[model samples]
Target: MALGLALPAAAQNVDGVVRPAWAPSGLPDRVVLSPGADAARQMAVAWRTDARQADAVAEIVEAIDGPAFESRARTVDGLSTDGVVRGGHGRYHTVRFTDLKPGAGYLYRVKGADGWSEWLSFRTAADEAAPFRILYFGDTQNSILSKGARTIRAGLMRTSPDVVVHAGDLTGRSHDWEWGEWTAAGGYGYAMVPQIPAAGNHEYSDDDDGRRRLGPLWAAQFALPENGAEGVVETSYYTDYQGVRFIVLDGTAGTSLDALDAQTRWLDRTLASSTARWNIVIQHQPIYTCARPNDTEALKAAWEPIYRARNVDMVLQGHDHCYSRITDGDGKASGEARRAQGAAQGPVYVVSVAGPKMYGLNDRALTQPDRVAADTQMYQTIDVEAGRLRYRAYTVSGVLYDAVDVVRAADGTKTLREPVESLPPLRLCDGDVGPDGAPCVGSAK
Candidate 1:
């Protein structure tokens, strides 16, 4: 069968698209793995199929030394919702894996009309504070099938990540074809490791009633943890994995729900209740912008104090199509993360993009960002250890862009350690053209 079937020209993307395959659903496409409320003992998988499948079941078994593993498998019938995604009618199936054994390998597959899907494997998080790694992406919102796929695939090849974090804008639109293209770009990698995605502006669209709605494909595409702040449960949620407490937030504007107040209280409580050694926040829009001249002023006014009072370690964000790392509002580059004695640590805010769309750096990026880049595709690898956390940013070509380490002491204080190393010369666009001499793929809006 073809990897992805093309849509008739009439159904071609309204805006330009790089990856443009649609799922017809004899077999499942867009298979993705996401962490459940508790990562150490539970996970979830979501996939799409044609309406012909009235029901679907997921079978999981512990992976063992031999092919007889199927004999001990357990089956769970997942919930399915049939809907129209931009003119395509299909069913989205999701199953929550309960009672999973921590730090153990498990194999699973989904059922379709013809047969079961090829076996896929995943490992649960360790039971306690232990070493692990997470891959963070800014936005794969455009040219996902072309330029974005390269960086996503490159990161997977470089490190075996235990969890993936997406700072929203997974697609330019909520159309199913674009969603399929996104899943195809990640391929099995999305199915193998758990992904935590925050909602982005592009993921929302006006409904037939003229009411704005969270991308129809969202809550359906990735089976995200539902344990979130009240009112925004579908888009704002949290997941505890290894020694990290990862909070997913919904900051998208003009959606049906008003998230400002409800999410603010939730943020305070969520951070106050954190028991994990590492606390990380993932939001699509930045409280501080690197590409846009205006900051997310509302977000900063409401949540910045909460983040600081809680000592949140990192803020992973997207929605600017540029890259930035700032430690505070002083406009001074965060020269080193490892601070000297008596210096308190603050959340190190990072904004980046992985998709083909690139935007020029703004004034804050020029003066405040410890690191900044333009017209480049990048990926970040975060290594989580019991006493320390290490971070590295690499361009799609695999050259290091930035590196930092946060060392945690027994008293819960963190010191910074920024590596001193030279990377490939920074690439900045020459007006509408890129440093490589090709027309810049980013819109520079």
Candidate 2:
């Protein structure tokens, strides 16, 4: 009376349950676009293929109205590396496209063992200072496929950003499957939009020798610019896009003895040399903690003064598992008072979380956060113009949660403007009950 009763028990319990749809195969998969140091004329893409496809082959052509554009396509060769993934051997390939026309759209595809992948399109940054939208996510560490996908899709679909920035902790443990999940969750969007990623603590793991090292897949998956501090080339880098100079720092490496000193010097040099209209620092650990009892004092001591001295516009960070935007470092005056007094604004610090994992807000959350959220997954969008930067945060359902405008004067002073309209009430857990009246899923720090 039972259906498929003849099937063997072992056959019924195959490992297909955990295998990702975007797993490495004869066909190219996990294609992601990343920017070079100068995005106006160069961009790079990375993908995975089966071992049979050892060589990295790609073709690019300026996008056109007709499908015959492939006639003008030119083949480009790239570097390839082989590694074991999910108990199987595969090859990762990275191809950097140079001398591309500024502000032009181009289509590209990679080759696999059997055939070529579908043509994915991307646009190069403008040669001059221009307005652009940036989608920023704090962390997509846990439940990347199940929970992180919705938030990522919301930001991508709603904002249609020119670029995406990850604060860090992209995966829970940097497992091969976790990386696969991250790529699968974003789907084709990862191929189209250029991503700026920072390295989180989770991106490092203990080797058999009991020494922690950066994850293996990091180098193989994303081809980032090597213009960073010495010894952290793969984990730290900087890129200038449109009118913003994004300086990505590795917080995990900062814990080391000499790495922080080297990075601090590099930070000063890079910031001093930046010609972009806006400067933003991206990293993992927050200078001001929202969920944790104590702030990241080491980062604050080493980088805070540099940020102030360099006049950084914003410091985007993650790892708190909550949301916070700190405009006033001292927390002595209200946002209105500080803005009305025309006090010189330092770099605005923001900490956020985009994953399912949650943590309770700590004592500092009471005084620091101008906007705060708990037990909620969110994404932020920043609209960058010559004189003003508009930032807005949205929930997974696309509801506006927070808004702020940083207006810059001709003299280079910044003023923080609060929300024009009423924002949704702060989302926080009541004792052990969540904002949704359900059992709280977050843990107390």
Candidate 3:
């Protein structure tokens, strides 16, 4: 999904591990906002300051039309954790604002040694199921700023999404410079829209002893909802926004950081008890893949049945660095025509890559997926309503690439209805030349 550009000093070297410079620190940097499980009642924000600013402080006030808004302001102190990132010491701060009014706009700011950060504004979700939009991005791993930033900006410019969901691998290497470019790429987008980030394999570190732990930056950078399986609380969690239930799972099934069984059990219970009209699962690795030679057989064997039995609407995934959309019985025969015959549908599995790291589509790319793309960077936008949901996919430059509409039935069932839309021609490599008239990049293996 990427074609690399000469990176700036702010980016990492070819190794993706070592980098130059300590994190810039005059004001708060890498500010991010995450929605609590009960988005209508609580919100969470995390920001990075220098190690000197050990104590964390933040304040929130109802956004007023004029400048006289200090009377009703509420200030809160939060827990701060200090750690070494890329060899330099820094402090990260997080604060959760609870007992908030649903469907209200609020302005908040964090404090540092120099002064308080710029006042940022955000709106909470409504108390009940309502119309809302969300933006989804696959791995923004390679060439984050040089290539992936444009894709993120394209999403910001095109729609008004209530939430932003990352299918994982925000960076190829969990280093400071890569994260810097990622933040600069998204810029204020991360602060404005509530983030629902899933943990990717690249985000974990396998120690010499073969124990897998989250990268130093993951847990410290974002405060996610805690409503997950008790054993895998850090990476496995779920959030309910408006009327949609977003179940996030860690897909490192057999790794040292394995949580496949706990997550499987939690997913079943979560879906069974869900009252939301729509249910969507987000994870790092794909249940079905177009880039890798085969699917994550472990994930498919464990989670696929639960997704089907629960009647989940969509399974958003990343880590393959390729694009694919596979529906049930899609590859067998009469894929699209299966709709012609009366048969119940299951969750739509999607795998996409947004960063510059590109991989060749597997042989099944042509037949298994409803649609597939290789060496292409793209983004997807989903709009949710009371009984209808619409999903649209677009290229980095903002061209509509794919889409479908879903209608909820009277019995809490849903149906994906493909809408007719024109898209650009498929991109492929001709000998050694690419569709861009440049050397064909990425892998075809």
Candidate 4:
């Protein structure tokens, strides 16, 4: 009898076995690492898979040597949401891993119906007081793959940051393809570095019941810390890493006075009790915007006072596609007006964009900002050391567009490092079109 005759329909010879092509059961996309209470001890892993794999599981193992390492596995089943697009509905599943050891390097993999994903490795942040870096990107909401993706990849190549802070607008729309592009933009970097994302306007959509519902992809894809403010689960939260306290606020929720009051109280308490040497606030809307004609009044009214009172070191924001670094001193733009108005060591507000959307700098940008850039896609890398924090803003072309450093003294005063290489004056135009021919100004209403 022929060997083929003895083989089963799904089986073949040893060397010539007709095996099925490896069709990965679920695509392990949008993988992210999140920090727990203890940076050196715990981490959170999150990922999304197709609807077919409702029960998504993650396995983590400690890396003893090279690729092969000892490991432990944990399985988490996620909730599913039906997202209808065009005429069809798709399902998305999210799973998270918690209780990881701090500062330890671990390898993780996700399993779906078809199979398991390739092992990805990530190291938790070092114990408190360990110097580290973080990548900051603003508004990767439009043209994520075409224009924004390159900028994000460039930033990752420049520095291996411990975490990534996105200033909202992670996607232009809640559409799946947009989410796909958003995930692709980060590529493998997101899987490697834990991401701390704040909610943006685009992350909310009207549900079938006419009530506002979080975009199905937002929370489903990220396993954020549950330490957000009261009444809000994952929207507003604070995380401490290496003596730095990152207060992430939800501007949408804080837009109303009532909501703002609640968050304000929480923020005050969080800041007042924070023991971190460095305190930075991250939000979606800018309290002081460089692209918008006026600042976000609601946010400014509720948060700026706290920032000033708390001696917050920095304010990182997006929503405006321009670049700005608003400090206390009137360096290049400082005049008598600014000197009298500027805070003596108040919070340094920075608004930048890493996406393709371009907006012209506001009229005040040229005259107000210690540093400003218009019609340029950029990302920021900040390095925090024992007594100093250095920030470098680079354009997509890898040009050092702006640079600043803040040195904190034992007395709590911060010394500012001014921009050294200044670019040409930003040509003010009458229309909305920026110097790069993209619409700079958006609807004021």
Tell me, by TM-score, which candidate is best: 2
Which stretches of candidate 2 lie above 4 Å from their native place? 1-23, 85-88, 256-258, 332-335
How many residue pairs of model 3 clash at the backbone?
1
- The sequence of per-residue lDDT tens digits that candidate 4 reaches over residues 1-445 is 0000011122112252223321112565566667665556666666655557666577777766764453344555544444343211234444555565667877887765567777777787666676889889999987777777878888887767778899998887666566666776676777777788888777767668766556766766677777778876667888788788888888866763246777888899999999899999999889887777778898788888889889899989998877888884234445334435643456788998888776766667776777787777888988999988888888888877777778887878776755577655543444677655756544332
Over the stretch 96-156, how does candidate 3's per-residue lDDT look in tens digits?
A: 8899899999999888877888788889988999999989999998778878887888787
Please give each candidate's TM-score: 0.92, 0.94, 0.93, 0.84
Worst 10 residues of 1 by lDDT: 1-10
Off by over 4 Å in 3: 1-22, 85-88, 253-256, 329-334
Q: What value of lDDT does candidate 4 attain over all alpha carbons?
A: 0.71
Task: Report the candidate with higher lDDT, 1 versus 4.
Answer: 1
**Better structure of 1 and 2 per TM-score:** 2
- Taken over the whole model, the C-alpha lDDT of each candidate is 0.81, 0.85, 0.80, 0.71
What are the runs in model 1 whose C-alpha is more than 4 Å off?
1-21, 85-87, 208-210, 253-257, 333-342, 430-433, 440-445
Give the runs in model 4 whose Cα sits over 4 Å from its true position: 1-25, 70-96, 206-212, 256-258, 329-344, 419-445
Please rank every candidate by lDDT, starting with the best: 2, 1, 3, 4
- Candidate order (TM-score): 2, 3, 1, 4
lDDT string, candidate 1, 1-445, tens digits: 0122222222345553423356455687778999987898999999877788768689999999788888899999989888464344578889999998999999999877666788888999988989988999989988777668877888777777888899999989887667766887788888888998998988888789876777778878888888888877888889999889999888874124567888889888988999989999999889888888788888889888999899899999999998787876666444332344356768889998998888887766777877788888889989998887898898888889888887889999877776787766666776788878998665545
* lDDT at position 275, candidate 4: 88
Q: Give the TM-score of candidate 4.
A: 0.84
Question: Positional deviation of 315 in candidate 3, in angstroms?
Answer: 0.5
